[model samples]
Structure formats: structure tokens, C-alpha cells
Target: MAERLTTQQVAEQLGVKVETVYAYASRGQLSSERAPGGKGSTFDAREVAELAARGRRTPMRPNAAGEPPAGEPWASRPVTVRTGLTLIENGRLYYRGQDAVELAARHGFEAAIGWLWGLGSDAPVTLRVPPATAEALARASAALPDGIRLPDRLRISATVAAALDPLRFDLREQTVQAAGAALIAGMVEALPRTAPDPGPDASLAARLWSRLASAAPAPEALACLDRALVLLMDHELAVSAVAARVAASARAHPYAVVSAGLGATDGPLHGAASPLAHRLLGEVLVGGAVPVVSDYLRTGRPIPGLGHRLYPEGDPRAVALLDAVGRLDGGAAVVAAVAEVEAAAGPAGRPALRANIDLALAAMALAAGMPAEAGEVVFAVARTPGWLAHAVEEYREEPLRMRARGSYTGPRPSEGPERPEHPVPSSS
Candidate 1:
């Protein structure tokens, strides 16, 4: 009998998440069979090795028109976007050549945003909205039912802010940067506060903590939140950033660019990961990680907040944030739960999945006594600056340049009944 490998073994061999191994099986790139007693699926070791070899093969280059080869789908063509914002290389992340982890430790979120927007790193950024604008946003948000999620409130608030700002359409560098700061502030302020307002003079993270947590702000917790904001401020060409750039390519205003980005950010695979991870960690903290992980595996759900594709070794942002989270009063327990979850998911002789930023965000939320949706709120607010940065970049490009030609995959028009052309009525 040929040797068969478990899913974890195959994932380790391919240097991918276990979920990706199932994806390969679903796509017919590999085949699977029932293991003994039908507990789990197993794959032929030789077949898995062949699939890995194929994945390592060199990809075809685009032709003269910068398109995929004939008969290949247009979606198969890689889009190369030039960016000076952020870089993820060798399991490390950098914002414009500066080490992101170092920057987060040494600078505030606003300072990082200033640097990313081409302003000096030490440039003072005031993330405040005019009193009238704040009142209007509060009223508008108040109109929504209390049951609405924080992220939805943020989306609605962005729209309201855009409507109220007559100068939102200004795409000039300084103007957009100013508007971006205020937009972030307004989004944070619009949320119904769970604690007393930290006042406008407080750091953005401090202000945000008031909204997300009912407890008074602790110095270390506030510091962790600030670091998280700086670490998440931007990632080069993320899904939300791409959506924002697409809006900017059409010359949309900064607010609309953020709205587009938010639309893409609300999905489970993207911005919502943090909240899911939060719930996952909460469950682990209660009933223990082993059974929770086993339950997730039994249901074939990809463990939330593990194994980011961009960081095979580990997510640096997660490392920095998790380290900061460990210093929180009760954070050590939560961090231990995260580790237990990781260990439970990866057995002996398998590559252990590393925690991602979402997991770290969840840890922060759990340790800080935040609501389940706190991580999602943090993600939305933190990434707003990033989306705006991309908007500024896209505004400088040729308008509508991000548009792509669609390849029709439906039934051919010729296959349908041909309609007779109707004569145009003459204007008498």
C-alpha cells in the first residue's frame, strides 16, 4: 500500500495552512480518502508531493499587452501595483523602509500616519472634528437602533461625515490628510461611549478605548492599543486598500474611498477576523483550547486568526502586539489560551500555525474586557488611515486606470435566439 499523509502533514509539507490543503483537494489538484474509522481525510504522499512540485513550477509571464496567454482567464494575470507605503518581506513588515514594530513602539498612531502621508514623523496630527460636525455625527448615529454593530455605525458615520464636509472632494495632499484625520476621529467619537470621554486632547487610542471598553483606561492597555493602531495603520495593497484605490481611480473623494474600503473590509476573511478570533479566544478561555480546537476541526472550519498567508514564519505585527498584550493585568491568561489553541491545532511533527494580527487583536480585546465586536471596531478605525493613504496615491494616477476588461464566461450571445432589428421611428 502507498504511504498516506494526514492533512496536517500535507500542509506542513506544502508550507500552507491546512485549509489550503482542502482547497487543493476541492479544486481537484489533489485527492483525498477517508482515514481509518473515517475520522479524517488522508492524502497520498506521492500525489501530494507531485502537487507541491507543480505549485513550485515557474508561472507564465504576461505577453506584450501585459495579459495572460491565450485561453487563460484574465483573472489569472497578476496585477503589479507600485506602492511606497508598506512592505511585507521575509516575515517582516516595514512602513516606507522603517521597521513597523520599532515605529509602533516608539511613536504614536498619528505620528505614523503623518509619516505615511509624507508629513514628517514628528508632525503633530490633531484627530478632532469640529463641534458642529461632532454633534451632527452623534445625532445621526443615535438615529440607528442600539443593536447595530460598531462597524455598521462606522460605515453610517462615514457617509454622514462625507455629506457634512463640503471640502471632502478636495484631493490635494494636505487637504486629504487633514480630512482623513478628522474622519478617523469622527468615526471613533460617533460610537456610543462605554466609558467617559477621554477628551479630544487624548491620544486616538485612548479615545477609542473609552468607546470600546467600559473600564477606565490603564496606561499599559492604552499603550497596547496605540501600538496596535500604528501596526495596523497600513499594509501595502490589502483588499480594502485595493478597493479604496479603485474608488480613487474613479476620482472618488476621500470619504467615498474609505466607504469603498469599508465595504470590502466587513467580510469574514478580512476585517471581521478579529471579532471571530475574539469569540474563539473567549470560548477557549472558558472550556479550554483543546476541545474548542477539536470542535472547530470537527466542523472543518479554518481556525480563526491563525496562519496568515503573507507570513509563513509568523506575523510580526502579531508578535509585537501580543507581547504588549502580555503585560496587561490579566493578559497572560489570554495569551496562554492563544498558545494552547495553537498547540492544540498543530500536533507533534506538524508545522505549528503562527498567530496573526487578528488573534492578537482578539487577545487585547479579551484581556481588556471589551465586547466581542471591539476587535472589528479597532480594525475599521485603524485601517481608515491606510485606506486614505491609498486614496491619496490613487488620486495622483490617471483617472479610472484601475478598470479591468471583463472576460465573458457566460453562454455565448450566438447561442441565444437572434432578435430582428427594429426600425427606428422617424421624428416627424
Candidate 2:
């Protein structure tokens, strides 16, 4: 058995007061056991000596400026990461100093993207996918397994497109913007199309709509879908955006940055939220609202489309998109079902729960007669511009700067031999 030492003996060996020894035990730096018959606690001599030895060998490490960095994980605490892109304030979102809601309402999705990219609103938003590039992306995407989701197919296409772009490593503003536009256009054209292409001059919404729905969409439905894209363009520093920035910080090519964002968006709680919300909206559209709401609530899961933490007063973007939905033909059933569901989900005092952007996208998809997963496709395409903009921003900063520091909680490097895998044979 390892030798044991009384608190006084441990304190003397370590040149610390007895109280300091007690503090070490309390802090788990020292292991102690109680003695029988009201005797004082004693520490394992081996443990105490090992800890002291580690302390002596390990010198304090501070930076050249002589200040030690914080040890706590930033994830558990609120941290300020500076970015001038999108700002969420007073329950409203702003993209580069313009109100996001107003921008979505008054301008096209590409115009809002220009603003995020530091281009003046009057700057032209280009959507031109070179014929050769589009063909290559199509061929690559077509080879993916049928069971893969649309976003995964886009990710694969991104890889192939990046491989083809010789100037992909060019971090200049004009070059990055050109690459971003071609990538978005290629992704849209590469998506499996059902309805006829509205031609090259068609708006992005028109082009993407053809791929998503078999039937033609009403003009108002196209407007609503376009607005949804604008609203989703940038939400200041989302998880996927952070992932994109991390890649950009490493100076990864723009297509690679978007590939990173797409990878992060594949998570259920992030970009995939729209599809789940789409499913709920479909059930409500097919079944009556009350029964569907009851059945969904009975499962003890929060309704997917309702409420967002950032918009307690209600998501203004959702309000804006839903207003456009109101203008759609045959939109009453969807609007009414949404209203009944919202009514059934009466708030319990905290500013009143409201439908979020996911619900808005789902409503738009349903009203436009698109498939349940179409909302996710729209989200991925819409967010591409913002991802590239962030990549540009990251390229100007220090490389590999977003790395996280971890606190050591595992076995120490100086730890003595671990317990034997098989105890030494009892030499009886």
C-alpha cells in the first residue's frame, strides 16, 4: 500500500501551513482519508509528493506582455467577438448598418448581399455561372447517392467547383465576389430541376423555384421566397458562420469556406431546423390544426416553428415574410392554420411567443406547393453570400485565430505508473 501522512507531516514536507494542506484536499489537488476513532484526516503520501513535484517542475507561463490569458472556457461565458456584418439589436437584425427587415422588403436578395459584402446598394449583383463550371458541378452532384439530402449534394459540388477554380486562392474583394456569384448560380442550376427553367435572365428566386417545385409559382409566391432568402442571408455570427470564419481564418478557398458552412449547417439544431419545421407545417396543412397541434404537443417536443430566443417580441423577419405570404393566391388555409396553431400556443407572460423564420420559410414552401425539404435548400442558397463575405473578412485577419483553449482535466503528464492492467501475481 502507498504510504500515508498526517496533515502536519504533509504541511512540513511541502513547506506550507497545515491549513494550506486542508485547502489542497478541499480543492482535490490532494487525496485524503479519515482516520478511525475521531483521529484527524491523513493524506496519501504518494499523492502529496507527486503534486509538490509537479508544482516545482512546472514554471508559470505568461505571454511576453506578462499577462496570463483567461483559463475559463469562453463557451460557458458571454464573449464579445467583434464583427461589423450583421447586428442583432432590440429584437431586430441589421446587415451592415441597414435594417434587415426593410432591406428584405424593399430590395432583392442580391442587393442585400451586396450591402453585406461592403458594396454600395447601387452596385450590381451578378449571378452568372460559367457553362463549363455548371456542367462540372451537375456531373459531380449527379453521382451522389440518391439518399443524400440536397445540402450534402451541394457540399460535394462545392468541392468539385473549388478544384476547377484556378484563381480560388485569390483573396481580393472583386475576385471573391465573382467566385461567390458563380458558386451560387452553379448550385441553383445544379439542383435537380422539375419545372422548366425560366431562362438565364430570371431572378435567383425564379431559377431556384423551378428546381424546387414542379408547378409554376405565383408572382407573389416568388416575391415571398425572395424575401425569405434576404432574411436568411446573414444572422450575425451563427454557428455555421463561425465555422465558415474558422476556415477562412485558415485562408481556405471561398468554395472551401462555404463547404465548411454547409458541413456545419447539416446539424439538426442549426440549418436543418427549417426542414423539421417544414414537416410540422405539412402535417398541419394535411390534418386539422387543432388535432395536429395536440398530437405534436403530446409528444412533449416544442413546436419546431414557434418562438426564437433572439426575438421575444416576435421575429420581425418572420412578420415580414408572413406578410408577403398573405399576398399569395390560395394562401388562406396555410395562414389560418398557422394562426390557429399560434393561438393554441398562447404565451405564458414572456412577451408572447411568435412564429420564427423557420415557420415563415415553411409557410412559403407549403404555399408555393414545394416539397417539405425545399425550405432547407432555400436557406443554404441564401446564406452562401454571407458565408463568402465572412470568409473575406477572416482572410484579412490573423490566420488560425479562432482556435479554442482547453483546460486540462485528464491525468497529468507527470503522473506515476497507472494501476496495473493485471495485478502482479500474488507471490504466495
Q: In lDDT terms, which candidate is top?
A: 1
**Candidate 1 global lDDT:** 0.86
**Candidate 1 local lDDT, 108-165, one digit each (tens):** 9989988777786888578998888899998998888869999999999899999999
**Candidate 2 TM-score, C-alpha based:** 0.78
lDDT of each candidate versus the true structure = 0.86, 0.81
Query: Candidate 1: minimum summed lDDT over ten consecutive residues — where?
Result: 69-78
RMSD in Å for model 1? 13.5
Clashes of 1: 0
lDDT of 2 by residue, 1-428 (tens): 87889888988877667876776777677888897565898889888777677645544344324453233212221233568899999998999889998988888877777788888777748888988898898787777778677777777778878888999999887899999999998888778888987989998988999989888777788888899999999888899899999998777899999999988888767777878877877787788667877887789977878888888888998888888887887677777767777866765564435788888888888888888788888889999999998888887764555655467899667667569788898889
> TM-score for all predictions?
0.79, 0.78
Off by over 4 Å in 1: 1-79, 415-428
Off by over 4 Å in 2: 1-80, 347-352, 414-428
- The candidate maximizing TM-score is 1
Error of 1 at 83 (Å): 1.0
Model 2 weakest lDDT span, ten residues long: 69-78
- C-alpha lDDT of candidate 2 relative to the true structure: 0.81
